[model samples]
Target chain A: MTPEQEKEKEEKGEQEEQVLVLDAMKRYRNGEIWDFEDDMAVSDGHGGGENGVLLGLDGGTTSTVCICLPMVPSFSHSQLQSLPILARAVAGCSNHNSVGEIAARETLEQVMADALSKCGSKRSSVRAVCLAVSGVNHPTDQQRILNWLRDIFPSHVKLYVRNDAVAALASGTMGRLHGCVLIAGTGTIAYGFTEDGKEARAAGAGPVLGDWGSGYGIAAQALTAVVKAHDGRGPSTRLTNSILQALGLSSAEELIGWTYADPSWARIAALVPLVVSCAEAGDEVANKILLESVQELASSVKAVVERLGLSGQDGKDAFPLVMVGGVLEANRRWDIGKEVVNCISKYFPRVLPIRPKVEPAVGAAWLAWNFFMKECYS
Target chain B: MTPEQEKEKEEKGEQEEQVLVLDAMKRYRNGEIWDFEDDMAVSDGHGGGENGVLLGLDGGTTSTVCICLPMVPSFSHSQLQSLPILARAVAGCSNHNSVGEIAARETLEQVMADALSKCGSKRSSVRAVCLAVSGVNHPTDQQRILNWLRDIFPSHVKLYVRNDAVAALASGTMGRLHGCVLIAGTGTIAYGFTEDGKEARAAGAGPVLGDWGSGYGIAAQALTAVVKAHDGRGPSTRLTNSILQALGLSSAEELIGWTYADPSWARIAALVPLVVSCAEAGDEVANKILLESVQELASSVKAVVERLGLSGQDGKDAFPLVMVGGVLEANRRWDIGKEVVNCISKYFPRVLPIRPKVEPAVGAAWLAWNFFMKECYS
Candidate 1:
């Protein structure tokens, strides 16, 4: 197809996606999605202090971050912008999918206690709590989390729980709550909604089924390459020496024992930079790993865009492509982001992927603000 | 390099390797290596009854096999050939690298008890007990194993401990106490000795550091390819469907959870037939996986042959390339054995690879016989 025809086709698809989002928004406002007042108490605006605060948490596969900040009313854009981060704390992984229930609970509670301690806010003073966890993809997941987290706050504090992708998208679009969020950290998943409320996801099944372009995925590849070289089944690469040294492992044999014994996704993810450096130093295997990773991430973004019928949208008309997670962040120095840009450019030339302006905890705060403000306005 | 030149170079390398093995053997026989009647107790020729028996155990990464038989003396080669397997029992993994110490010992004990029950013999009736496990490579490992096994055997029973590779070599050569054994079971490792008694190994570190062409290795490759296909980073393969189905997992994502929860190298290796079938059905990825696996096994076999200076030895003089393990057995139908033979033909045209005629446990029994006979003659 000619570029002109392709552009026209893309515009039509974007128009369709916008319509889907709008329809979903109408359904949501009509009380057709996500809640009931008895199970989840939302916007019971009467109880919180005058300077009502919302605790926002972004719980990732490998780590969790919590931020306490004052929540403002719906109409105040400047208030949303200037809202101070009262306290911020980071903790180890709390995702139930990755860590067991007890570990996840401990990490979450630790971060919550730390944040509350820093902010000096009593349970009564807290107005709302929003936790964006990577595995909170279903209503059942959210409800389980709500029950678990109820002990951390006063009975009246409105609780919001959603997957981290929601906070990620909110972060890039300033809490508009629609558009794509592509995550390539310890795990990889792309999720988003059109303005019309049509939500979709691509990838994010984790390392077993999917999780392409994730740090774990990259590390797995580097390991496979190293072993193949050792067995004389694959080409030689400098990754053999660098990966072992970077991980502080004496021999490659120790990795299985270490991984299975403790099971740390974050530690494996931490090896991405070493791979990136090797790629930069012209190691073919490393370069191949990066290229494949780039393709996986781009494909994830494209999957969401296509599912939302927003493929080939013009740069101006395209949904904001929010990129988050350590893998994407690590590549900021390796020209990989540019490579990512180029791969997705065919389907999204008018769009550009950018990291969140604020930390993910702050992004969760923005999601809380958006949730409450939408309630007040509706 | 030309084939003739390559052959010549391989011969020289083999000569060097053979010399090294001879030197090590000399040192061992001179009481300069391993131990002197401490951790390992060789047959003192003064144990139990006149019709004393031996218990041989082959402890693999995933499975354990125990066989009990009468130990005929040095002059009874005919008796050795006709000796029946009195009892045999299979148990769970006894590899310390894969399972913890307690689990390994429990498995060993369980299998031992089961075999003894079937044979209708008391622990005292067993004059010698020899166990060969895959992961017990170092002298320290052997020492630890010796200490662990002593509690299971009667005080009068002579106990010998060595790695499983020794038993594999023994099985192929009918207890020759020399030549190479190639194991491609749940884990991969090629081990052999020169005629002069120099022992060496290539690969077999387990899935983390080595074990290429192992069942675990093949499974890892299959998983990687499937996920890559799902994400469009690799070609599509029948493996994507076959592997999931074989594991009773609906999606690839569940494999990570399945693997981490149970962590069975043998379970993963069990997928080898499915991969082989897919390759037979013309799945490019599956075919590629098999081809690579074939080459790795060949390379492993070649490593041992060269080290023992048996590279070009023909007929009876050639080092027996003993192929053991689930993988080698599985390939009997796939002509993978033929493929393997072809790969190694250049270096060892006169020698051929063969599966053991007897069970690996029987090989352990043979090792016990050799140990006792060596004591009697020396």
Candidate 2:
């Protein structure tokens, strides 16, 4: 084809994609098209389901999830589990550090919009919103997010903002903050809280800051091994062939091009499954990587627990240790999460491990309920 | 200022900068304004100096350099030292993997233009051109570059394309392609060639694929140590204070923002000197990082040497080991280069280390001379 024809074809393709996206957005906004939320709709008489909804956002480097829940004022912590999830929505990264402040804010706003719209609710129906997002290291970050959230909802709506790790902790503890949470997804971080509200954290500085237990870090080390083996700098391992074939590459040299072509942390982290598979197959190098990752992850939790005194003065006091994310959730024979718990148990014998039944976004919604109730009754 | 006014001011500043660059380009083309080349202009009687010139380019990730040398048909290899550099030019990155293909080509072309113009020479007077560039891993990369080089020069002019590591090796060997060369600047790679022309390379896959002997890798590890210390995961070290002050950061949390802010490997690699300083000051963490880097660097060289059989069956055959880049030239109290050499010497006792007096651009020029002469005489 001529250059003009090629240009025309490209433009047509772009236009079609844009139209499809717009149509999807329209259908999504009209959530009446989906029966998932409608089937779960309840008419509880305690001014819970129909009276109001809570928006809980867990914004991370990989993706942002918003969970809309009925604002049920549970008298006991166990009752919180029964709260119906009114609507759920997902979007791309909302971490201010990864995506700039404007983009991050837009993502948070759009996800909240989608959740509320899906539940056939509006901003006016939102009783409270808790945005627990990654990259919220400072009070300034918290206040900035809160200020923008104020712009989205009415002044009467209650707002609570915390680091995304807080939501992960709350997820396993049924909204109680007095526990430790170890998240090992594309990145890793350990955060802990005491009964009296004191808090401490370890890791969570991203891959460059040496969160080696993270999926990104584990996969990167695996890739490095492939390179070293091909170049004769390291012992030839099964990983070279395993990773090369998984990536549809013929040689280890091509891995370099494949890596930098798109330096997204998630893309590399996606290879964590293959690493696990290799380790399960008894590849020494892959097993070593997983073992090292477990140690690194346990160290993060230990650091947080020791600092926050979660295991008490005698170090035998029982404390809930929330395990979250893909790396931790791997239940294969070479289970990274099980190994991490075992490692942690050596230091804190009373470490009570909990794998949350719900996701972190629901934990955020629970936090919204807790914060709103405390303000109203206390 | 208002947004519109601020944009206008920014546009105005950009225009001024563009004008200055254009003016500099004009002055560069009118290289007669400088007298460095004029003072060395010799009219030798053998159609050597006044007859023609050779162009050599060393294109790297950080920068690209072009060297212009008089085409002297020297009888002996020792006579190559007497050849005077006619002109020299520098430009930004020309690695197509780092930059796009068009931008890399433009930079190469412009730098060549600058060198020829500075030496009061034209394409017609060029006897040969040798381009030694980074990211030339495949034969396809070499062919693409050669095709473009062909478009620029006359059919009579001979051209050669090679990986940037070849120029580095040639630099220490004085244009010979035998023995091993190890470069550990922002990245690390060991490349070797046998007397019979069998060549091999190790590492140079970059930081992701484990060039941990690199300046970038050393610095990144140091940063990780600081984060570990701050988060209570590792032992306390002097690197925390030293690196934080060097980077003008207030806290460990700030280091995360500082790191991903730019994400340029060179920017992170710049911290290598600080890490060395910390090691010299008796910081154990810093010392360990350097020691590991030493082993990594030495391993790359050993891999290349053993693969090429630079050491004969007795394992004591003499071979030139070319050491290049800032990491090797540190000359610090805790010398990394010295340690690497010491490590490699245990395996190959007759390893002769040579630090090149001339830059790689000159080596590229020497390569041009070698290529041109061989074709004419053979």
Candidate 3:
């Protein structure tokens, strides 16, 4: 053989050896995971539970939740609000961006198994599954997740996958995907959908790429203001005293240490309430931060609505605007959600605001029912 | 013993055991590190080479540099610009915030040792050492590093510690501390000192705390603009095309994935050139970003100058404005450093902008000389 060919062969052999070791490890793990199924009685591929069951999962950076609901044949679409939940299981961090793909997949699978075990249902008894996960940005992400689900379920079972924002929107609209949903928790994103299946999103890129309307963003700005004030770059405000006392820090310089000690976005976001309190107490800097945040949040919703044409061409159309997350749930004297709603109303006069009565997991379960019905009955 | 007392004793025992293990490991590592010193012949805590030597170290997030200079007793302060550098050594990150305290200390110690060893000098032969490192925000940070130096060198070796910005300032002023220094690289900060030893600083807080003039900040805003334009939240610009092309991304959506794949500030900051390119090509969005960054950079310098009274009571007195870092040395048609100088000149028209002829490590060495002379001959 030529020297180059010989080298290629040697490298190929080493790669094959590595792949074999990885495959063996995976098989062992899969065997241990599926051991619980061996105890079940053998039956046809049909469901064991009455009318079977539907699985819905809402996976996020902080936690993954799987909800089990009965696929009652008699229930109509109008009764989505009354759908009874069979079981729910919770697990930690299923966002592939936060945790690696392998760990995220394992967490998702375990959560689904836990939910099924709680409801005394097997995989054959699952009729449909809808997974709404945080990291599902591209079609590739959705297809990869669908492939994983296909491996674990019978081919006859229906499956759907979407970004977690879809679940939030569905929760507010009772499974009808035709409006904009704004989520402003530790991070922020605005997602919208049309009834005919077109969808768009804005500002879910996390803190680095500038989701400035988020809880983390607002708190970070407040901290910056405190630093600016202490360093004589900006006007002094009550935030210096209030934030320092709240954190039990002696000076603004300590904030740098406190911020970088742990890079968790949620830890910094927890200071949002203090910012609100300061704004309510007439701190101009804090007030300005909140006002800017309101504008930012409104802009996100407006962007989505404008992109999806949820607002009609003339801009006078009634569309549900689902508002979720801690930043919006602030029912304070200086209500952020209220201000955002008002700001958007100037551009969209008929914008109907919604606060989801059910959690996102319930929305995912309803989505499973809806997607299954469409595929089977179309 | 009581149950609580027994529990406390057990916990204390575990803590002691852990400390002992860590201590033994540290001692072994330290022994390995200083083994070269043991091979050297013992010398008096005085001159080994002619007039001995002085060591200066500039420790930063990216890299650490140590410069060794011969101590010349006859050289006048006016001839400081021609100080001889005996040796130079380089090391990786020595910032305590980026690398842990132990690792940062080891890097600093190793670099200094390497510099001394290269020049055939010992710690005993060292006159004074000035370590100007990043992450030295508080007096406590300074004290902790000073304590580390105390353990490394003999008591007679006069040691000085300051923020890395001080070295940059001294570099432009030829070791004089009476000037303002503005550093705008991956991060940005403005530090100023008066002749009477009064000092002030502004905007040294990292990107989270709003160092908006920083390379990281400018690049992040550019990325944000791309996302906004893609999502229809902001005006479409050349940045969307320029940044995506630079990153080899197929679309703006891919930018999110590329960004979160690695959380390194410098990695993102590297995109500053692309933003600059787009702006120079007449992209309004990119132009606006640059303008805002210029204002932010100028604000920091103004804040420091005003606080330290470096511009005098009328804010028109001449003071050396030392400019350093890649952001300032753009040398392009759309020069960010030139704009910053122009902006600051409006308030202090006589602001003398100086780009340092020597690197910061050499400035640290000069600082060591000045500090040593003041202490010994005062």
Candidate 4:
């Protein structure tokens, strides 16, 4: 064998032979163990029936650590059954600055260690780990996370880290290589990838810049509209009453208090659907707001398509559009999806709508597996 | 004479022989006062006779005082000079609460005393004192102002007080009793009197309630549109750039400082015309804002007409609409006045567009004269 092939074989053998001493000791001592195999299935067609392995870790803005061992093509059912999944929410790690990311990494490592101990696994037994986190956008950020992971885990374990948005997109596509995904929860953004490896993005520049058609946008509109209505300068929409009721506010001064006191911009954004409901009920003011929102979202999509040069022939029919966000998914009845699809179809004739199939954690795991499996087999 | 007629005769004689002490004192002091008999003409056929008297006072939100004078036929051509019209803008007299109104009355009393001292004559020498003031529609408030005026002035002096809006309307019509007049400087309101003495009003609730199509309204719309544009959620308008440039602001954060530090809502409202200018220059956003403002104003007029029950009535032709206010008067190039006229004409076929001939203060004086000669007489 060539040197590279020998090295690959050694790595594969090492992985196969690896065992969690803690789990084996627990079994020998007759300790209780929970198995995760029921949640995952492995294909039996490759590598002389050796099960493929994957490890995913999601470090989100709100939640800290989520670890999963997903089934791969080569892993047997019994092997999968022996593994365990763990999720731990790290407390208070939402810093957008540099120091915050460092503190988050330390917390992630500690959580992973605790989760592995609970699962009766040793650090050496893990073949790969992927971390999906917020603010891991730049190459330097990725490197910091990877280095931190290497320092915590055994050298044999490979590490991959990416932004949470990437994982979200991947989860929706179930590992699909090409598609567009829109995330509209607290904030709104659209991202898409073409088959030719071109990528485009729009909105989601944070709360201050863009994030149009999101909960924040909706809340802002509702608030402004209420003020206008109160002043008798705007059409009297049902949203005025609804918002006042929702906030339990009687005056604009009360609203100022709510806005300034521990403001959950996302929570405020959640009131958007109520406005939409009023609009659907034929309230002119509410309808105007909704129409404006629709236009904003359309503009975002158009911007992405245009930016990616997806308008011309080379970009057509190259990717399916996928939407995977709490707001967009929850608002299926509102026809937001239909509106988006129609808008996109205006420019891209062969637009295909695909529902996301996998959780973002699974995407992270898939990415880890792809990165590490190639390393193992060379 | 019977006791009642004798009392009436006595009151009439007193009113006819009395002279405004302030006018007489100013003429005596300034050495420019002409002899009343030599300079004044006899009754003109059109409303104003030599014996016709007018007392005009403008009681603004800022101050309260009176302009007491006798009217001569064709006084516009008369060159009889007088002291700078007795004017007062009493500080600390805003009627936000009932207490403020009481305080304003006390202040007005003091102001009247000061004016009386300047007049250098007995209080009984004043024939009439007319007050034009920002008035509350509530009868109690109206009675409060009138009672205060009566209490402050000598019982022999005929006292009259009406809203500044009435004064403005009278000014435009040269004391004509019927016509629509729009007041649109810092705030906007439309008031009209029908031939049958019915009154109609629109807008003019204040900056917080309505004031649609006024300077304040325009500024508010422009600021809101610019903020929306900054978020990429509003239609792109030229106002966005122009506003930032005018204010010397780079971002929305700078706007917060302006809002919080020395926040002058009226100053912000003044930016509307700049936005209108941009719209006229072919900025889509500016154009949209201007169109919306025009629509709002038109709607206000429509509301007034509806409230007055002028629909399907030939009497509508009798009260030609008059446009006033700084915006309407300043922006002659814009078609807002023409558009309003056109809109009104849709409802009233013979809607005449008449320019206001006198100041609103004159209207107040006309009301005062009417009260002295008619309502009080009856």
TM-score of each: 0.70, 0.85, 0.86, 0.54
TM, chain A, every candidate? 0.76, 0.84, 0.89, 0.75
DockQ of 2: 0.44
Once fitted onto the true fold, the runs of candidate 2 whose alpha carbons sit more than 4 angstroms away are A1-53, A71-74, A89-93, A96-127, A151-156, A376-378, B1-47, B50-52, B98-110, B113-125
Model 2: clashing residue pairs? Answer: none
Residue-pair clashes per candidate:
11, 0, 0, 18
Candidate 1 chain B worst ten-residue window by lDDT: B31-40
lDDT of 3 by residue, B1-378 (tens): 754575578779999999998886785466555667777766632333658899989999889999999887677777877777888999999999878998899899889988887777888789999999998877999999999899998898999999999999988987788889999999999999999999999997899999999999999999999998998889999999888988899999888889988989999999998988999999999999999999999999999999889988887789999999989999899999999999999999999999998999999998988888888877
Lowest-sum lDDT 10-residue window in model 2 chain A: A39-48
**Model 4 misplacement above 4 A:** A1-293, A308-337, A349-378, B1-84, B90-170, B173-179, B183-244, B249-264, B279-288, B311-316, B354-362
Per-residue accuracy of model 2 over B1-378 as CA lDDT, tens digit each: 855575578679999999998876665455433333344434321123555998889999889999998887754566776788888999999999889997898789888878877777777678999999998988999999999888777899899999999898878887888899999999899999998879999998878888888999999999999999988899999999998998899998889889988878989999999999999999999999999999999999999998889999888999999999999999889999999999999999999999999999999988888888888866
TM-score between candidate 4 chain A and the true chain A: 0.75
Whole-model lDDT for model 2 versus the true structure?
Answer: 0.87
lDDT, candidate 4, B1-378, per-residue tens: 655575578678777667565565555444232222233233221122234344566566655544434543333322223313433223335342424664666555554444433333234445566766675555566777777567544576677655667777766655555767766666777776765778866666554344557777677666656655654446677776787888899865356346545435467567766866886788877677667767767666666655565443654444556677666666545566676677667767665666665555545655555555554455
**lDDT per residue as tens, model 1, B19-126:** 998886664344232232233233432232367678899998668999987767744644575777878989989998779886787678778767766656666567
Task: State the lDDT of candidate 2 residue by residue for A58-151, as single tens digits.
Answer: 9988799999988766455578898888889999999998789978977888888778767777666679999999888788989998898887
> Of the candidates shown, which would achieve the greatest DockQ relative to the real structure?
2
Which residues of candidate 3, in runs, are more than 4 Å off?
A: A1-50, A72-75, A97-106, A113-125, B1-50, B97-106, B116-125, B140-156
Candidate 4 lDDT for residue B27:
50
